[model samples]
Target: MMIHAMSASALSQMDQPAFVAALDGIFEHSPWVAGRAWPQRPFASREALLDSLVDTLRSAPRSDQLALIRAHPELAGKRAMHGALSAASIREQLGAGLLACMPEEFALIRDFNTAYKAKFGFPFVIAMSGLWRGDIIAAMARRLAHEPEVEFAEALAQIARIAALRLAERVAD
Candidate 1:
């Protein structure tokens, strides 16, 4: 697939559907974030567009927020192991070295995935760009202890970090 990069000015000029399509993959499977934030475009900077998108997610109802979080596949879990993740997810995990774990670490991460989901009702979501598998494991261990409300907030923050990274990749300063 070809990645279409354009100036923020050009992106700001797009019609709604085109804008939504352009940013479709930024939030995993939730293009609605862009769609809902569409009217806020002609963004003065990439940061403004990012703020709009993240704000949309932040203001979403509880169920929708949960849906967005749940849309992300577990790290190194079945979907990733089976190669079913989105391109950005693949690169993020592969960059973090989550895809090449030793057997022991892999099993531990799988266990964390199961327990974390059972506890929080959503898969663990982290921005995996500069992290190593060990860092991910430590983060999972640490975040697993958070209360549901706290964890939920943390999840959104992490998603925002991820969106910021992705937006930077697709949009220029």
Candidate 2:
């Protein structure tokens, strides 16, 4: 196996603990994701590190994966309303126009969250980095109809996308 090095200057220099600390929130509240990926460092580039992060997650047991998925807060739900989200999540949701939803749009999201969670046993996961609220609403409605297994896979994929975006922003290639 080829072992590569971390490319982000600060990240490249960190010991395992510090490195995990720096990336703790990249995968929502799952710092263990970064902790697991640290053994594979130094990553050759940011993308490689992100791949490792996603790979670590993909290798996890189903229960662990579900836990990671459930760790995310609902978009425009109680967390957003009460400022309980992580700083990164707040910025991401706000940028996606979730925090600016008109009353009707907000209610729609609330309804969707309720229905989606009731179906899948976890929050609907999406990468809202550059998406508008309408896009999110449409996707949520469409995804709600997916089979449980399909939706579970899709949720993991979306989480990877979110983690990739967050990691990219934090680490320069």
Candidate 3:
């Protein structure tokens, strides 16, 4: 029975390294994200799997989304755990090295985080892709102006996008 299952799994994985790699990479970084078994079965098609993963992520509650966001460190700070996130994610979070250049923006991020959390009960969430420090600070200011209900929905949507991109990287083409 074990041999049969193993053989079935091996057959399912044929010519699907990219898909397997994507899922493995995500699980390696965040094993508890969805609380599923490791070495997940190979996806039949990349698009279908990505769609399902996005749906799964979108369905997650706000608390779950916040947990995932909190797993990420501040964009530029000593507390950042470098290897846990994608390089692009790290760069975006750090704000294209602006945090190194401007101390005030760092202060702003700290203040915004406090205010945003006090107002919305969750950390500020952003995709952080292709964003510079000034851009991030600007976004923080703008988002700070949002009502809790608006911000909560936006945060979840952004989280879903981030998860989808991460999952897509793992799926077979």
Candidate 4:
């Protein structure tokens, strides 16, 4: 699982498969975002690469977009409880202190996840890189009140933010 330190210049020159391999995990379980955005390569900067990837997700079909959103696991939910999250998600959630939650905190988050999913038809999503679990819970509660369309857009934006953080970690500035 060694990640070679690939410069932006080096990454820009890669073939589609290579490019996707280097960046596929940045968007949780959605490697197709990078695969589809491969044609927009030769990025002049890391920001450009990020913009291309996010743009690809933004322009995807609704079904594909929903699938991408649904690809994310619930916070402190079954996946976290069972230790089944993807490596990227595990790191993000663990860093957010989700793995350290007390039983009461876990139950509160699980309840929020169930109610939120029931109402919105998707799990709550947020860029958890620097967030505390409490802050995440607060935000989730607030977003539960948003209209579906608004929440959908917000989820995509949060995914983009998560991707941006992941890109910064993996790619050179």
RMSD of each candidate?
1.6, 4.4, 7.4, 1.7
lDDT of 1 by residue, 78-133 (tens): 99999999999999999999999999999999999999999999999999878899
The estimated TM-scores of all candidates read 0.97, 0.93, 0.66, 0.95
Candidate 4 local lDDT, residue 100:
96
lDDT of 1: 0.92
In order, candidate lDDTs are: 0.92, 0.89, 0.57, 0.90
Q: Which digits, one per residue and each the tens of the lDDT, describe model 2 over residues 1-173?
A: 11232356557678889998888778989998988888887777888788889999999999999999999999899988999999888988999999999999999999999999999999999999779999999999999999999999999999999988787677777
Kindly report which residue stretches of model 1 are placed more than 4 angstroms away from their true locations once superposed.
1-3
Query: Of the pair 2 and 4, which is ahead by TM-score?
Result: 4
For model 4, the local distance difference test gives 0.90
lDDT of 3 by residue, 130-150 (tens): 667677778878998998778
| CA shift of 111, model 4, Å | 0.7
Superposition TM-score, candidate 4 onto the true structure: 0.95
The candidate 3 region of ten consecutive residues with least summed lDDT is 1-10
**Residue range with the least summed lDDT across 10 consecutive positions in model 1:** 1-10
Clashing residue pairs, candidate 4?
none
Q: Which clashing pairs does model 1 show?
A: none
Q: Which residue segments of model 3 deviate by more than 4 Å?
A: 1-44, 81-91
The candidate that wins on lDDT is 1
